[model samples]
Target chain A: MTLVLFVQHLANGLITGGLYALVAIGLSLIYGVLRIINFAHGEIFAVGAYVGFFLWRVLGVPLPLAFVGAMVGTAAMGVAAERLVFRPLRFADPLNSMISAIGLSFLLQNLILQVGGAEPRRLDPFMSGVLLVGPIALPLQYLFILGLAGVLIAAIEVYLRRAWNGLALRASSQDLGTAALMGVSIDRLARVTFAAASALAAAAGVLVGSVFLLQPTMGVSMAAKCFVVVILGGVGNLPGAIVGGLVLGVAESLAVAYVSTALRDVVAFVVLIVALLFRPQGLLRGA
Target chain B: MLALDRVTAVYTGRAVLHEVSLRVAPGEIVAMIGANGSGKSTTLKVITGGLRPVGGQVLLDGEPLEALAPEAVVGRGIALVPEGRRVFPRLTVVENLRIGAYSRADRNRYREDAARVFELFPVLAQRARQEAGTLSGGEQQMLAIGRALMARPRWLLLDEPSLGLAPKVIDVVWDAIQKINADGLAVLLVEQKAFAALQLAARAYVLENGRIVAEGPSATLAADPRVKQAYLSF
Candidate 1:
């Protein structure tokens, strides 16, 4: 591949990788606290994109406002889901929770399909422009996505590092029962973690939706990518997720350019499997 | 002050605590001494709000604690340094201390309390940036106790703090507990280490198979013929 094309693909990969990190971070946080892999996580991401699309279409809200709305609204839905479904199942077996989450995922997907139809809906970018650097071209929208992800990740990292609530969250992840005895409100922490994760997924969805068409099934692909990132990053390790995402993103982008566009998703999975085979804990660390 | 009035609890329909009653008055150290399955830890769980009592009430300052959540119960000034020295393994010593103050929103006092915890557990202060999991068992126990103290609780509920530590470490921990009580925080200590627990407590209760078999002044209970023959067999 030409150097120009490779550089172009690298930019594309980093943006996608950053988004993957955002999504995986949420998944890791929820899994950390509740110890259940939320099957509906992808659907939550999809719902976020839909929310952003609808807000832009029906309410004529600005892109920024719609993005926030989508995140907040999805987070609200996440909180409601935790309260109505997951919270009740706390005493139930972990397998039961996993099943319930899967059921919820299908339920949300069908609900969206029934209401919005199966058509791939388009959302115009709020700004359409291109920037050119030495032998490389960049889209302003891609830069926005990267910037947004950076700010959000930075904010979350700060809160997790400095806040008491963040410490409680970490403690819950380490051991739920022990955390409770230490005076952490486990239920509340679970809800908040769910909400935060949902919100991140929502934001990622909205950012990506502006660039790509939104469909009910769009989340499945990202979900697959997110899983790859999670595996590559390692379970319960946040930094690993970020690194995994970027690695997957860059690898996938390069494969699309140098190898074949059709092998784009394949590259990520292969990398993930290899990462698992070599370092099952992940590329960075383990829980 | 904390009081458990006929508190009963069950896990998965099998009862673990049956009508367990205990009390820790302000500034006093109360110990629950028993064998492995004697419901001492369950009693601590009941008081800490980790397990809701199936029957009767947990009262803090005469208010029924059954209605409050675990963290809220902490907000009401009760903290439990649970069994097994359950310090957050991945967290640094300082982070563990900060988490202890989860119920407090006052930033200024939180800093002061953290400094005080460091003062109490100087080892923790030395390893403030170290991950808690890497510490030795005795050090982890100190961190757990230090973490509980960061809450600035009126009543500190310690479940078997000296369970796995050596006698010297136990002495170090008990000294800290005694110093904590001297600083006016009431303590509810549950331990299978009957002799060490009784030495620290003002009043002590003997638990057997989920029931309190005897209750008296710490020294008297420690000297009881039954206690002497059973738990304190030295």
Candidate 2:
């Protein structure tokens, strides 16, 4: 491939990886504290897209408001899922909770399919036009995705480090029984985690829906890739999820560019296998 | 003041503590000494709300702590420096200290509590930025106590504070515990080192096979023939 084409593919990979990071970080956060793999996380992402679509198209809300609406709406769904589905299963085995998540995922997808139909739906671009930096032509939408993801991730990092509740959340993740002794309410922390993770996933969903298209099955592939990113990064590590997402994104982009499109979906699994073999602890050691 | 009134705790349908009763009056340092699997730790768990009693009640200042969660128990001014010095391993010392104040409503008092902790363990102050996992075992134990102190607790529960420490370090820990008790905070300590616990506590209880076999003033217990024969061997 030409140098310009390679750079273009690199940019595409980074942007796509940003989306993956957003999704995977949420998954990792829930898993870290709650110790349950949220199989329904991808469905939450899809729900965000539909929420954003309806808010923008049907309600004629502004783009930013619609984005917020999607996030808030999906966050409510997340809180509901935790209270209604996961809360009762809190003390059960991890496998039982994970199976419940899978069941919830299927239920969500079927619900979406019945309401929105099987056809893929598209949203109007949140931005338009392109900017050229040297020989590379960069789309504005990609820039928006990169900018938004950067802001949200930075905010989360800040909250985890500096805020009191965030510190409690981090502490709870490290040692639950001790954290409780320290006066960190595990129930409230779990609810906050679900809401935050769901919001991030919703943001990714809206961004991806605008750039590409949304369908009931979109979450399946997205969830698969996110799980790969989480495990490759480290199961419960936050920074690991971001790095894992970018690496997978860039690798997949390079695979599509230098090899064939058929190699795109296979790249993450290959990396996952390689990571499990050599660094089962994770690419990052701990949270 | 904290009291366990005939608290009987079970694990997997088997009783671990059989109607254990204990109390820590204000400004008192009380110790519970026992052998392995003797349910001393289980007794601490019952007080901290880590485990529910199958029978009887835990009371704080004569108020029932029956329905309170662990954090709520902390809010009522009870903090547990749990066994194993379970600090947030990845967090900085200061961060871990701050988390101890997680349920506190007064931000200024939290700051003051942090200052008091730093004063109590100056070593923690010097290495405030270091990850807790990097601290020496003794330092980790100090951090664990310091973290509990940050909650501004009226009563403290310490489990095996001297579990793995050098003699000099254990002295430092004992001194800190005594100093904190001098500040009017009641303490309930559980220790495997029965002799040291008896030396430090004003009163002590001997637990064997999940029952309190002996309870009296520490000095009297230490001088008792059976207590000396069973626990004070060189």
Candidate 3:
């Protein structure tokens, strides 16, 4: 590949990695505190896309408003899921909660399939046009995704560092008993975490739906990829998730560009295996 | 002003504390001494709402703390410095202390309370920006207590405050606890280091096999033959 082609592929990889980070960060955050691997997280992403579609196409809302509506809608779904499903299983074995999450995932996937049918759907782009920088041509949609992901991730980092509720969330993730003793309400924190995670996933969903196509099974592959990102980064480490996502995205993009398009899907699993072999603690050390 | 009246707590269907009753009046320092696995920590668990008592009642200021969660217990002005000094390992010293005030409605008092903690433990202030896990065992213990104090608790439930610390370090911790108590904060201390705890506390209770075996003033307990034989070695 020419240098320009390589740079373009790298840029595309970085953008894809950012989206993966967005989804994986939510999974990692929820897992860090709740100790439950939310199997249904990808389904929540799908739900977000559907919400965006309905708001834009049927309700005639503008794209940007529909994006916000999708995020809010998915956040509500996440809060409800925590209250109805996860909270009840809080004290059960981690395996039990994890299994419950799997069941929930299947239930949600099938429900969406029944409602929206098996056909894939697409969302209109929020903006149009591209920018050319020398030999590289960059799509405006990709740039928009990159910028939004950067802003959102930075906002979350700031909130976790500076906000009161965010501090409580971090404290509870470290030591729930001690956190509670310090007056951090575990129940409320759980709800907030769910909302935050779902919102991130929803944003990714809306963005991806605009770029690609949305289907019921879309979450399955997305979930698989994000889980790999989570493991590659470190299970409960937020920074790890971000780095892991980028690494996986770049690896896949490079493989597709330099080698073969058929090898794109295999790249994430290969990286995950390599990571687990060398650094079971993850690329970053975590709880 | 916290009371556990005939509180019975269980772990996995086995009783850890059976009919355990204890009280700390306003600003009183009460120590509960016991051998390992004798339910000292379990009693604190009941008071802090970490474990629900299978039988009996826990009261704060004469009001029953029935089915209240741990955070609610903190809202009622009680904080537990759990055993093992479980400070957030990844968080900075200041962040850990800030989280202690997580339930406070008045955010303005946080700065003042944090300053008070720094005053109590100058070392913690020195390491304010450092991660908590990097602290020595003694400093971590101090941080645990300091973090609890950030809650501005009416009563502090301390579980094994001096565990795994050197004798010199233990003295510093004990002195800090006494100083905290002197400031009109009630303390419910659970310790396997019976001798030092008795010396620091006004009243003491001894537990064996989850039952209170003896109770009296600290001086009287120190002199008691049974207490000395079981706990006061060296």
Who wins the DockQ comparison? 2
lDDT by residue (tens digit), candidate 3, A1-287: 39999999999999899999999999999999888899999999888888888899889999999999999999999999999999998988888889889998999899889988899999988778989998789999899999999999998999999999888888878888778788778889999999999999999999999999989988998899999999988888899999999999899999999999999899999998999899988898853
Best of the two (2, 3) by DockQ? 2
Global fold similarity of model 2 (TM-score): 0.97
Worst 10 residues of 2 chain A by lDDT: A177-186
Give candidate 1's chain B TM-score: 0.95
Show model 1 residue runs off by greater than 4 Å: B8-19, B54-56, B105-108
The order of the candidates by DockQ, greatest first, is: 2, 3, 1
Error of 2 at A168 (Å): 1.6
The global Cα lDDT (0 to 1) of model 2 is 0.91
The whole-model C-alpha lDDT of candidate 1 against the native structure comes to 0.85
Q: Give lDDT tens digits, candidate 2, residues A1-287.
A: 39999999999999999999999999999999888899999999999988898899888998889999999999999999999899999998888899999999999999989987899998878799998998899999899898899899998999899888888888888888888887777788888999999999999999999899999989999999999999998888899999999999999999998999999899999999999999998998853
lDDT of 1 at A133: 84
Which prediction has more favorable DockQ, 1 or 3? 3
Reference-based lDDT, each prediction: 0.85, 0.91, 0.91
What DockQ would you assign to candidate 2?
Answer: 0.87
Over B85-147, each residue of candidate 3 has an lDDT whose tens digit, in order, gives: 999998999999998888888864788999999998999999999999999999999999998
Model 1, A11-62: lDDT tens per residue? 9999999999899899888887788788889899999999998898889988
- Tell me how far the alpha carbon of residue A13 in candidate 1 is from the true structure, in angstroms, after superposition: 1.1
Q: After superposition, how far is residue A68 of candidate 3 from its true place, in Å?
A: 0.5
The Cα RMSD in angstroms, rounded to one decimal, for candidate 3 relative to the true structure is 1.8
